[model samples]
Target: MVDATIGQGGHSYLFGRALGPQGVVIGFDVDEKAMEKAEERLKTLKCRVILVHSNFSQIADELNNQGIKGADFILADLGVSSPQLGASEFGLSFLEDMPLDMRIDKRIQRSAADIIKYLDEKSLADLIYQYGEDRASRRIARFIVQSRKDFPITTTGRLANVVCRALGNRGKGRSRIHPATRTFQALRIAVNDELENLKALLDSAPEVLKRGGRIAVISFHSLEDRLVKYNFRKNKEENVYEIITKKPLIPTRQEISENRRCRSAKLRIARKISEGD
Candidate 1:
């Protein structure tokens, strides 16, 4: 089994407990802190645990290097963990001010601040619209550009303020979420190259799984869910996969009540198929 986004080993620990001593669970995470925490959490499990401090996009290569031919199961939880969002170093939240560094992996050269500082107005607007699905991207970009001219937008609070000011009262009264939410999400995605990394992982899945092996992906937003949906559907058409969920399985009301952040989660599963099957 492989846990692709093994955030704090919550999923891995549960799965590891069910595995026999001979069973192996290889986990991948780009965040070194997550890997360290996961190692501590999974240490008591009976199964052999191998934690890799790297992106899931490199799963195939890592597995091969470990002399693993194929895996029986692969699981990816695409949502950012609550701890990650709250960690001041990640700079993922607008609720409190933090340095505007949204890179999940510190190895990445560019931060959210770099993107904001360097990207042109039109490009910034396009990035927000394409990645965030924000309709007010132009106004936000204009405001950001104008604000930066006065002083560099170096922190999360300042960026949020700029976005809120751009949309005025409409940002507060009409929306349940903060006005800066979409803009921040856009910047985070860009800083991490998230969509492309997801594409790489999806593309590598069929080759990495053993025959009849299954893969499950839990995505938190429409962009991530849509990618998973289309990839599974396309693989099914090619007889490379058998879609397990006819429609995405969403979180139950009970589950959402227990963990409000999971309300937007959508889980999809698929099994690999060969010519004989």
Candidate 2:
């Protein structure tokens, strides 16, 4: 079993408990703190737990180095974890005032602050449009570029304020989502190189899983859901794997009410259909 992006080990703990003593579970996370938390939680589990501080895109090579050719089951829950959003260091949420650093992996040199300060207006606008899918990307980029001229926009609060100012305050009982939500999400995704990492994972998963092995991915946004959908369809057409979920599965209304973040999540499953050379 493999748990990619094993955030707080919530999913892996359950996977480990079911695996028993004979089963081995390999987990990956970019955040050292998250790995530490996961270790503490999974310490007493019956299965052998191996945790690595790395991105899931490296899963194929990592497994091969450990003398494991293929896994029977693999799972990836993509997106920012709850703790990350609440943590000040990550700067993932605008709900709290924090440094504009969204690098989950501290090793990453370029941060959200760097992007805000360095990126040209057109490039920034393009990034916002492509990643955030926001129609007012140009206006937001203009606001950011103009705001940073007076002083470096180095805090989440300032960035959020700029976005809200550029887009205008529609949050006054008009919309549940904040005006800065999409822009913040775009910055987070860019800082982490999320989409490319996800693509790499998708490209490598089939080869890493054994024939009949199952792979499950839980994505939190439309961009991710679309990528999973099309990739699964392409793989199915090529006879590499069979899609287990015809349509992506979403959280129930009850689940959404209990956990508002789960409202956007979609789960897609697929199984390897052929053996590798």
Candidate 3:
């Protein structure tokens, strides 16, 4: 079993428990802080396991180095983790007043700060609209570019507030969802190259799966879901895999009512084709 995005080892520990002694569990996360926390959490789990500090996008090479031919189960949960969002210097949440840094891995040189500074206004607007699906991307981009004329936009809260001013038209109260949600998402996606990384991960998954092995992906956004959908369909058409979930498995109403974050999550699965079909 491979638990990609093993943030805080929640799912990894579960996999470790499920696998027992007969199976091995491999988990990967790019954040060292998360690695430490997850390692601590999984210390008592009784299973043969290896925790890797690397991006799951490089799973093929990492698994190869670990002498794993292919895993029977692969789980990739694509979204920023709560730890990354809540307890980190790298700003991921608009609610937080922190530096504009949003790189999931500290190794990555580019940051949300760097992206906004370097990317042209057109590119910035496009990024917000495409990745963020932001309705007021143009207004937000214009405001950001103009604001930098006074001083560089350096903090997440400051930027969020700016986006809110530019886009929000309040009668009684603030928006149901913060006006900054889309802007923050756009910045994070650009900082991490998330869409490209997701594409690469999906492209490489089939090759790293043993025959009849299953791969599960949980995507939180439309961009990711579309890529997963297209790639899974393409692979199945090529006879490389079979779609395990004809339709994505969305959270139950009860689950969504309890955890609002899980509302947007779409879980899809596919199995590598058995030898000789």
Among these predicted structures, which one has the highest lDDT? 1
For candidate 3, lDDT tens digit of each residue in 67-158?
98978998999978866788548777778788889988889998898887777788889999998998678888998888888888888877
**Least accurate stretch of 10 residues (summed lDDT) in model 3?**
168-177
TM-score head-to-head 2 vs 3, winner? 2
TM-score of each: 0.97, 0.97, 0.94
lDDT values for all models:
0.92, 0.91, 0.85
Local distance difference test, candidate 1: 0.92
Tens-digit per-residue lDDT, 64-156, candidate 2:
888988899989999989999999989887988899999999999999999999999999999999999888899999999999999889999
Tens-place lDDT digits, model 1, residues 167-194: 9988988679889989998998899999
Alpha carbon deviation, residue 147, candidate 1 (Å)? 0.5
How far out, in Å, is residue 6 in model 2?
Answer: 0.8
How many residue pairs clash (N, CA or C atoms closer than 3 angstroms) in each of the candidate models, in the order given? 0, 0, 0
